[model samples]
Target: MSHGVKKRKLDKNAQESLYFDSYSDVTIHEEMIADRVRTSTYRAAILRNAEAIRGRVVLDVGAGTGVLSVFCAQAGAGRVYAVEACSIAEQAVKIVKQNQMEDRIEVIRGTVETIDLPESVDVIVSEWMGYALLHESMLGSVLFARDKWLKPGGLILPCRAELYVAPVSDPVVEERLNFWCTVRDQYGVDMSCMSDFAKRCILSGDIAVTPVTVEDVLSHPARIAELDLRSVTAEQLRSVRGEFACECFGSSAVNALCVWFTVTFPCEDNKTLVLSTSPFKPETHWKQAVLYLDEPTDVMQDTKVAGEIHMYPSEDSARHICIHVDYTIGEHKKHSKTFSIPDGYSEAQQ
Candidate 1:
């Protein structure tokens, strides 16, 4: 091989290594296991679709700790292949054995794309969501598995996913911006001038992973994107774009746009099980992703905030996400800004 090709390969490997290595930590697994809202929903969804899983081969992509694989075995799946690329897969092997399900569930340590399955899967189950739904781009792996190993008429748990965005009045941003003013009162320094710099620092195109309250919401959320896992393509995953228009509930300052997602599992008789990570819903480890506007927009009741949002992978690394917003509040001039997950922050940990 050539020197340039080797450098490119190393760069790609380094980026992927950083992502997989984070999952090796125990704290991340503890957080996901402790997220009742996430775990219970998957368990219920699997059991609810027992007919589809029972006596069928199953594949669990990005199977961290093999929890979902065990769930499949409980659902009477004939065989379950749990594919994980991180060091955590070793622990998953022990976990499966401890549960005395070693025979039914086989934990394989490798990316779904590279691993070879003995047979096609009848059902694919995975907890592939990230902050704002697409932050870590793990769905790409699910899609790869689905296309390569899923049998015809096979099922994908949480087959549908929807992304939502709402205008929010974040007091946290207000508090942070106001803190500069208080520096003179408490520390006897005229540091209020730093407020502008702080505003720029906070809103300078980096998405914030933080908790948002129901009361902080200024308007009803609009669905920005929907992914039908069965039909969604890898090319489509490159850029998920949608337009939204939300009317303000009451006069308030819209400091940021909060994004969340919900996935649905199809059950018997058209029933569906939904797992939501919304501020309006119970809190989860994957908190709301907030994009603070550089300049907060003031609005009256019923004012419309119309805009387009484009979410895609960053050029430097496919796992990293970039979000671009182009919006106009009421009759104000059009405004545009872009945001991204900060470097070194692993959305996979969420």
Candidate 2:
């Protein structure tokens, strides 16, 4: 959906969506979402700030099932613009009516970019994070909405996010790689290295290797990037570049470096009321991003290493990421690189 003032469809598909047509061409995992509904920490701000919402104009993008919209209405919002993109928006309508507050909440069925908003909104609340906060890259659309619709002083929920990096050692990924090599070796003895086919799957299985949690990686994460929700746009977040130097804390076998970051929303106090990722959070859809050393690095305890990594978001529709990493451990130099989805690119990488 394109961002514009007039309420208009971007293409034929968008026009068809206006009818709330079923996706007969594609299969939806309805069974998977049957048991799920929704997050925490925002409850206090959402429930406690009754006055803030009481007479204010609010917008809820991707307001799946319309629960939050109803909450805003319950808080006395004068106009609650609830936007949803799924066919089940009818359920949200039913829920709104069951609560007996349809008068204050308006359910709009379309992408926020396509929906016509009457005027600027005082608040924009959205649950747009996807696995690690950038997976789907829907943040771009949100920014477009922010620039086009939010007035000065408008509030965006979960207002800050940070990216962190660290040196890590893990036995799991190494073991899995050896297992694949062994299996292929045995197959070659029988005049059928065709098992290379089986070995290939392990390489594509991003998680086939054991994952080193955030705790293992961040001895002390040197902050790389900190973004304020008050003003961040899709274009700006597309590429993250940084030069980071860290030390190998112990004699460790480094097959790859694991990188995971987090987003935190602060309360009135400086404390993080809700942290999205980083070392403090449980793994979300965003798995720890990896940069392999290709050939292992046997770092002596207490060696100084300087390195840098560049993360480029995929330009394709999939919104993947391509990562390049280079480093010098003590006197030894090593590197590894890989591209994101729709690709399995790997090189000697210097």
Candidate 3:
């Protein structure tokens, strides 16, 4: 490729990295129903514990495919506010009627952040777990709605949540570092060799450095960020920064970071409902994204290094949840992000 073409590709990868960095891989749309949504472990947790919804005013946030909302109605909610964005909101509307819940379930076709509600709810029912349970970052929207319309004592599904991190076995890291070293060498011979190095840097990694879900990082995860659903907010979620002092496993280059968290809500009978581990679950078609590190670092196990990560929500749309993560490992760094809708758009454009 020509010099300019390669530059464009590198820049494009960076942009995509940011756009998809925080998106989940589950799909709860019509196409994702039986195969993806209904059988999810997260959803299973909710149905297993249903006593919380009996005769309650429940608000279902991100009511995609209307699965969770319909379930809330079936659980005997006094009234179900099925709020959703995207065309799937129409599907949710149809599902409410198909389930003969048109009288009890109201479908609001807008983001949870700005939708209007007729009354305060007794409970908030939503499946907002993205890949790693926060990619779509829909929890912020849920929290916003709760603060605005949910009764003080109302229930929120996925009441408690936690993010875990661990060291894992990955060979991709070594390959990436070696490639970067090669590129640095070639640069001495030819300044034009820069483009090849950039592309190779994107591809090579013996250890893994992408922003993978924390679940994939270790067999058993260590809780990095534990959060409560009722009180967490978008502003508080702006940055996920932490310091890690551990070995890189030498073979592991620590190309990217993987982060995953879980949400737990209390259902009836003191049983807990969960999203990340339920037979019935919401769907996100996007796979857990891997945020490529801007740079890679190498070390061995028990190596002491500090790092910080961030997921920024775009202040742009009613439901815009974007992410930006920067990990400073040792002296090297890498970052990835998924843009919330862009911020600062004019009223007419918004």
Candidate 4:
């Protein structure tokens, strides 16, 4: 038996947050399912290890449309609990029934932190990564589910996750900044002064979720941090800090630090299946997070760029994240900046 929330009306802000947090919109689920890299990776991870799933009980945390639960059912799971916190749970029930998995899968409409399962699960599967991997704060719920319902030595899908960072030259950002200055001549007005203000507005300490090409990379990416989900604690995730150093490929205007993540699933054969959202790999809905510098730095070949990255949950919204970066371009040049992932980007913008 699972405890569920009773029907209740919520205010506007509460409603908005629920929608954003739960991804209640069908279109959002459509986009996520349509992402070949993301969906295929999870499918492969589950189907490849059918032996482990057979006759096992599974729990799908934050199961929006119950897709992962369906995958586990198809993989021969005896029972699957699909937990969701918003209206999407109703749809998930329909999706499970439509797929003729109602007997094997149970859709529970409530937050995982509050929901109760009939028995402990042998496996916990979730796609909780947000923009830059921690923007949405849903990992906390997954961790809670793990502590409460996961069996001893139970498996977690994509057991390992790593964050990477590197320098990049974003011509698109430079052109946008320069456009603010060029408008002075086109409009026959002294608008060049607004360039400084425009730069601040555009780069106002928010993670830019944009696409970057491999050619735009100015240096080899460094692995900043790694999380073993099985042992990682929420307290440790509150302030994930890492140090990285990279050498510039050549003289280039390094305008931003590109950040991305990769997750790996351990197989029964001792092999690992990886799903990377790096610019060097196929793009997912997460694209890549670019933290633009207030002013671009020019670096020469062999120029060493070293930095420390600090990430934490935002004070205003737990679902949002704040990133602080301190870096040096050369022996004498040091700079530090703080950025955040805006609520809109995590919500409607996505």
- Write the residue-wise lDDT of candidate 3 on 40-132 in tens digits: 644665565566677788888877767777777766787888887666667667777888989988888777766778789888877666544
TM-score: model 3 vs. ground truth: 0.66
Q: Per-residue lDDT of 1-350 in model 4, one digit per residue for the tens? A: 11385434455467446645557676788889999999999999998878898999999998998999999999999999999887888889999989999999999988886778889999999999988899874788888888999899999997989999999999988888888678768887767888887787787787998888999999999999999999999899899999999999999988899999999998888899999999999889889999998788899998898989999977665667889999988774689999987545645554
Candidate 2 lDDT, 152-254, residue by residue in tens: 9876765676666666765665566556547546775442444455435434324211245754562455556666778876667777676777777777666
Cα lDDT, all candidates:
0.91, 0.60, 0.56, 0.87
Clash pairs, candidate 1, are: none
Candidate 2: deviation at residue 334, Å?
4.7
What lDDT is reached at residue 164 by model 4?
98
TM-score of 4: 0.93
TM-score for every candidate vs. truth? Answer: 0.95, 0.74, 0.66, 0.93
Write model 1 residue lDDT over 60-107, tens digit each, in one string: 999999999999999999999999999999999999999999989999
Q: After superposition, how far is residue 293 of candidate 3 from its true place, in Å?
A: 3.9
TM-score-based ranking: 1, 4, 2, 3
Q: Which runs of model 4 end up more than 4 angstroms from their true locations? A: 1-22
Off by over 4 Å in 2: 1-38, 48-51, 74-76, 180-211, 269-272, 283-287, 334-336, 342-350
10 residues in a row with least lDDT, candidate 3 = 341-350
